[model samples]
Target: MDLSVTVDDGVALLEMRRPPANHFDEVLIGGIVDAALGLDDDPRCRVIVLASEGRHFCAGADFGGGDFAADHVDAAARLYRRAVRLFEVRTPIVAAVQGTAVGGGLGLACAADFRVAEAGTRFVANFARLGFHQGFGLSVTLPELVGRQKATDMMLTARRVGGEEAYRIGLADRLAEPGRVRETARALALEIAASAPLAVRSMRATLRGDLAGRVRAALDHELAEQRVHWATRDAAEGIAASLARRSPVFTGE
Candidate 1:
């Protein structure tokens, strides 16, 4: 399993246990939802902290040696359910991101109510870099967090930004030292744990009601566009070149 959960003092810490890049396959992504969503029915868990044990917080979708999207219509729907499960978790989540959050990993960060990023952290939505549009509801959530122009600029260029820039753009609510992400995340989770659970759940419900529809719509658009790109020569060439570790010769093939 590439995921683990630890509980302490009414707060649950969900850790992505994959090492190095922590790139997620469908199974690992499903594991994340199961780990966090289970907390909703757990009477002892009052808050959740999403953290990772790796060189990077998360490197996004695993493209190392497999095609995750091949005839994957059902798989995509399951993935969407997992995303909804994360949103439906009643407990507020605080992400403890210490390094890079790329692509859908950025979407995972956006899923949380709060994010504590380390000073050395970097984030990039590299969907455009691969000729894919976007995924994980980020096309909607990014704009919700960082505003239209900033999100547009980032997504359009597939550029990377640092921790301070993340905070300035509201991608991360707070900044911490590299070693302090867990500590700070725990502290914030503890604060949420101390608050009234019913009220917190109500607030979360209200917010989700307001935003889930929009998020779903954006996800549909993103995935539809992304599927089109997947069949394009540029996307295939980019993926192949990326795996080959050589410069891509697109030729708009």
Candidate 2:
């Protein structure tokens, strides 16, 4: 299973079990969406702690992989469809980001209501460097979390933001000691679960009004842009350079 769900008291812990980088594909994202939706319907689950078992929370999609590049447009559309469902869940979520959250991995972290990260945790928006448009609703969620200027800076520059900087810039909601990210996230979730479940969900919904609709609209635009870029020479060069761990040289074409 790509995901595991365990409930304790009113907290549902949804762990992504894919190891090392935890790179996601359609199936993995679908499983996560299904698990979250299932937890949403369970009255016993008042909150969710999104976590991963690996050195990195998620490294994003493996664009170099055959499965991802095949039928790129259709695959992206299907992935976005499932990704949007994450926003529809009523339960509040706290993410434990222990390591690098790059590209769509950062998108997943931003999906949570709160995030707990250690000082070593790194958040990166690397699509521009990859020569593609951002996906996983980052066009909406990135700016929503860190404001338009900061989001643009991260996306365009493709810089890594450590946990301290992330917290200062409003990217990470809470900072944890090294090796305690998941525990801290669970503690925060427990705190949220202590509240009246109905009221908590109601308040969360009010605060996030129309977020799902906005993300859906953003995904359409993002996907269209990505489709165009995917066929470009720069995109190919960028992917090759990344795999080779070198700087990409782009041409106007």
lDDT of model 2 at residue 196?
87
User: In terms of TM-score, how similar is model 2 to the real structure?
Assistant: 0.98
Cα lDDT tens digits for candidate 2, 89-141: 88999999989999999999999999899999999999988898998899899
Once superposed on the true structure, which residue ranges of model 2 sit more than 4 Å away at CA?
A: none
Ten contiguous residues minimizing lDDT sum, candidate 1: 65-74
Runs in model 1 deviating more than 4 A are: 67-77, 245-253
lDDT of 1 by residue, 151-221 (tens): 99999888888989998889888888767988988998898888899998897787767576777787788
Estimate the TM-score of every prediction: 0.91, 0.98
Model 1 alpha-carbon miss at residue 8, Å? 0.5
lDDT of prediction 1: 0.81
